[model samples]
Target: MSQRVIAPKSRGFLFLDSHPGGCRRLVEEMWRAVPDPAPAGGEGPVALVIGSSAGYGLAATIAGLARVGIRGIGVCFEKAPGRRTGTAGWYRTAATARLAREHGRDMVFLNGDAFGDAVKEQVAGLLTERFGGKLDFLVYSVAAPRRTDPETGTVHSSVLRPIGSPHTTKTLVFDEHGAPEVKEITTAPAEGDDIEQTVAVMGGADWERWVTFLDGRSLLAEGFTTAALSYIGSPLTAAIYRQGTIGAAKSHLEATARTLDERLAKTLGGRAVTSVNAAAVTQSSTAIPGIALYAGLLRGVLGDAMVAPVGQLTQLWDRLTGARPLDPDDEGRVRLDTWELDPAVRKAVAERWSGATSGTVAELADLDWFGDEVRRLYGFSVPGIDYGAAVETDVPWPSAGA
Candidate 1:
């Protein structure tokens, strides 16, 4: 385990390597941001968090353990360190396990392909034996570019293209000076089976399958509650995001939520709903077209109104645990993006968006903060961590089968 000033290795937005110490620091900060855990509710409330390594999934896991005193099972796909550093999510999960133990909470972390049948079976077995065979809460937050269907053995990849005509919008891109600049970029419409593949990969199929499998085994507890994290961008990004292929996938997910709710309500009196969360700097969000600029301008316009991932999920725990009643929008979905979609906030962001240029974008948007946050996601540019000091790259994940 050797580490010394792990430099940024990136091709565009994708980070190739991560810093263990900095990633641990990131998770520790998330743990600190939420309320401390009450005494563990013994055999009372257990949660299953799919895709629980980064972004909203990771935050939901931390919130479940800290805010709701839940013992949880977290499923993620992350690589271990070898010649190069591991992924940021890997180090974050390791740190999260440590924090859970410190808080007297038990967490089972599984590292593998969560979309496959093997991992799902393993999770079911663990819940049956280790968790009294009942799951109280489930959070499905998987964001992947591609997925191999477990039943059919077919691979599906998600696309970020628009549905109908080409959509041109002001987007942020890197200039020759390695700085961000606003440019008008047009994305072509999806062709062939692009929309179908995107829906197959990102839609609610997997979420529905997970629920059905668990219910088949009689693992869903009475009054069981589930929330799948989702996002509905504003009109600024409507063409590329909200009305795009990914948008179709989100619609399918919401439809699945309604169907699952009906099924659960009739059988176990449980409910499943999609939580439309606020936009933030996440590993997946940064890769989406127009989202980076939207997030940057949003930070500048909304300022203190912008909520972090941890805060959003903490509120989710409140709703799931009965501390707060489940508030759904007209579409029967939990709308956490209300602040981001506020009329005042939208007007300000749109004004800045229309007037933003390569020269004036710095004045209109919080690009600096956005860049720093993106870097911090990969375990670089983190505060209080000595980047020059040696740290362990091969950190041990303290869980069986991880």
Candidate 2:
């Protein structure tokens, strides 16, 4: 019998699943939630997606193939099968690839550090040899802790700290037993070069680099479009998120989108833009201070309108393919978070935020649902999966030998 490995807990979150069922359910949800595709009346386009193993990137890839019949190539950094539990992303990619194959659509996953030039070259080669030497869509959705400059070899790591001063806020922490607790946590301000370092790690330099490399190699098809994701939360999180280290990075990312838009238009008759997405529990979002409480409250306020990654990306596709006209903000960026930022929703969240305490958290916010979302990120808490059954962690790469 295969060894039985249970979920692991750390820093108040449980890491579960040594199987693929949970990821399969996520993909199934995406297919079921998205509206049926209206034929675009042409050959299907090819997509190149960076950070495509999970979260927004994964959702985009699945939506592209399943809804619109686009062939996709995904790039991500996930653990290969080994002694320790393989990353949930690994199973997700494997299951998504299988789904794509079942539908007779092509989906290739390349697991590697997308920040490096080597991976870029490999993707370019794949495009030339197998994908007709051009891409119609490119999606950049990487969220990394540290990034090493491919040119300077200097390493930059990002931090979740406020900008100018220490800020105290209600933070959520889970115990080993998976019980949620709210505590008053204070985060210090960014130190010397911390902002710059965070920007280097999380900013648009690498995104622009990818575009430049693809454009220079003539890998972008005529009238090609590319999009990168960003976020601008409510005033409640401005101190810790929008006005903080990560916010600075997002600002840079949005700025890069403008520059790339002009560059694409002038050079390749293409377009580029940033899509400001809604908040949902993602692997990266869970680590941000105060985000857990904020997300739980936001969900409570928005309810059914609260778009997850799958919904956000599906809506993005509608805008991109002219199924719906692009309704962007004044900055020419898609505001996918508009629903979450609606006046009524924001008002409700603010009211709840003011009265929320450890004892009152569950009553004030959707902690139970929020916790389930967090567990879903790691392929846990998903229905119909037998957690007690022995799981085989050794799974093949979805795009092996491709």
Candidate 3:
């Protein structure tokens, strides 16, 4: 172990260094929140979680192993520790593997460019050789800023902006005093191929490719189900969220779900759906323009009623496993953000949104919780970690970079 003291280093939401001990503790907390007693024996259910290192993807992997007793293959692109500490996703993946071993569950981590064909072929080989060529679940929760097209070699970058016109809204930012302040910010609309590029990067093109690859190889298990995570925020964020460039990509994703659902059902009696999740402080969400402000207010209004990733995924598992029947919306998407978009909740949040100002923003929103959640996502501000102590930064991933 290359032991050295590490402290939280940051510029805005970009967390520079990750704490191994703190990451392990946070994973432990998430692990404990789900049910225990993984499947006892036999080659059990199998799951392929693309982008499985952080946020919804990581939580879904945990839910699969701890609650559903499924063997998991996680694919993510993460950096290892070198001159500085590795990415938080790196440490989090290591900790999740440790817990999986403790519970006698099979968890494999493949660190690579998941958007490329090489990693997809690698995953296919694992399924065929190790898991009897059967896959029960494929979770697509990837959040990337850019993607290089495997066929054309063209790179597409996703953007966050209002669709047709510039939208001005109140956003939360820290003042020079490090106090929460509401500031009015206007985001420019998409120009040229901005919408097309975002749809290429964040849309369902890659997801469809993955499904096509596995099915062509005859690797899809009977009754196999796949899902991709999505979001549709309230009116307060509609200009920049539900009706933005990213939203255009999300629309494409949901459309792909319909197409995949039909094809999977015809071929293997399988299913595909997009799971629209609620707002929270995730690595990706914190980067969005107005999500932080909206999420903070949502947290304040719906405290405790706001489900964490693990809780939301556990419910999803129940729906998938026949413990409960699937309840999908008219669009054939599982709506997990119902609570977030409830009329009463929306009314309360809108009132708060309209009345918010720099002075009263902190009081009207759960700014403390929002800040803490962002810190915890990168393995800082986790309870009971001595950040000053020297710790190992060079943690090994069992099969990373292979």
Q: In terms of lDDT, which candidate is stronger, 2 or 3?
A: 3
Compose the digit string of candidate 3's lDDT tens values, residues 136-234: 999999999999999999999999988888999888888656788888899999999999999999999999999999999989999999999898888
TM-score of each: 0.97, 0.95, 0.97
Kindly list the per-residue Cα lDDT of model 1 for residues 31-148, writing each as its tens digit: 8888755675454488999999999999999988888878869999998888888789999999889888877787899998988989989999999888889999999999999999
Residue clash pairs of candidate 1: none
Candidate 2's displacement at residue 120, Å, is 0.3
Query: What is candidate 1's local distance difference test score?
Result: 0.88
TM-score for predicted model 1 compared with the true structure: 0.97
Candidate 2 CA-lDDT value: 0.83
Better model by lDDT, 1 or 2? 1
| TM-score of predicted structure 3 | 0.97
Candidate 3 residue pairs that clash: none
Model 2: runs farther than 4 Å from truth? Answer: 1-5, 14-18, 37-43, 176-178, 400-402
